[model samples]
Target: MKLVRPLPAYLVQRYHGWKATTFAENKSWYRRLAEDGQHPRAMVISCCDSRVHVTSIFGADQGEFFIHRNIANLVPPYRPDGDYHGTSAAVEYAVTSLKVAHLVVLGHSGCGGVRGCFDMCSGHAPELEEETSFIGRWMELLRPGYERTAGCEGTEQRLRALEQQAVIISLENLLTFPFVRAAVEEESLTLHGLWNDIGSGGLEQYDPESDDFLPI
Candidate 1:
């Protein structure tokens, strides 16, 4: 109904217009998984931005990746009473419940949420208070990047640094989760950092090999 109906404008406009290849398969898949259980290959922590889709970016099939999205793709330091734990809850479910081995933190360039941290540009999204608070707090995790790149470049450079910082923040917060931490310590799970530049269709990865973000 949600997919067929036009009541929700976003769905009608964005999804209903497209030819859904997975709709039929997704219905059966959902029923089958609900009856039994789900076993996804990986878990992705990504931004709420529609352009940075994890599925199409990685060519993920049905039940391939469990995704959690939030503004700027933040993972706050572990706190049970964080008021808004929607992001963390999804992480908990992905790690503890699903036991996904590969966790990917996905960031992207030209992120409004990341730019909103400093209000370098106008972010008129009043409904995103949690993200407003979160971006403010989480950006601190990128202080080294800000410092390293400060007073040295244009606005675009700073924004790129913030995108990179988001990846670092997500990885750090993942370590704060006991389930995720234990899995990593036992060598059962591995964490990855990624940045997607939507404009150029460029995918940059955190190459530990080069100790820098590199084109992939």
Candidate 2:
């Protein structure tokens, strides 16, 4: 017998109904999106964690934000790659092509990527030495955070400190991009740092006021 996905009939019907409206009957909504160039108001850099989908947190519509996701949500210092700079390419496009007015780095609580980078720094993950590719190269952006917060009192405290520091690193990297920095200098762009606490269902903004995260 072929395997079948177990489903409640009502849920199946509702799901199909919504899918039809979102994709079939409502296909024009998406068609128009592609037809018209995307003009999102913000460019958000976030982690690839499934738990921290920023769109769900913000109730964003189809084209409200341009998104870039990477391990621990890093933004590398800009350099001439001689070719493709995947994350940096997204940043350039968002600032130059899309011209989004806001650039945001969305960090999250309990980020596994940050912990892995920290562990790699500790020689806990010896396999890191063998992997001389994308992950190894990318994790460079978070090393400063791992080093800075390693001495924090507890595991949770260390993680929070590292997470916050990672956000700042990304902000600095964003400034290294010529287009992004130009936009900021010209007063056409502003940047924000967000910490999403998944367990608490709370969003925190970096309160420059007290230099802490505060509920948004």
TM-score of each: 0.77, 0.86
Give the Cα-based TM-score of candidate 2 against the true structure: 0.86
- Residue-wise lDDT of candidate 1 within 46-127, one digit each (tens)? 8899888789988987678998888888787788884878878998898888989899999998887777763532344333
Task: List residue ranges in candidate 1 displaced over 4 A.
Answer: 1-31, 120-148
lDDT of each: 0.78, 0.85
Colliding residue pairs in candidate 2: none
Q: What is the lDDT of candidate 2?
A: 0.85
Most lDDT-accurate candidate = 2
- Candidate 1 lDDT trough over 10 residues, lowest sum: 120-129
The predictions' CA RMSDs to the true structure, in order, are 4.9, 4.4
The TM-score leader among the candidates is 2
Shift in Å, residue 211, candidate 2 = 3.7
How many clashes show up per model?
Answer: 0, 0
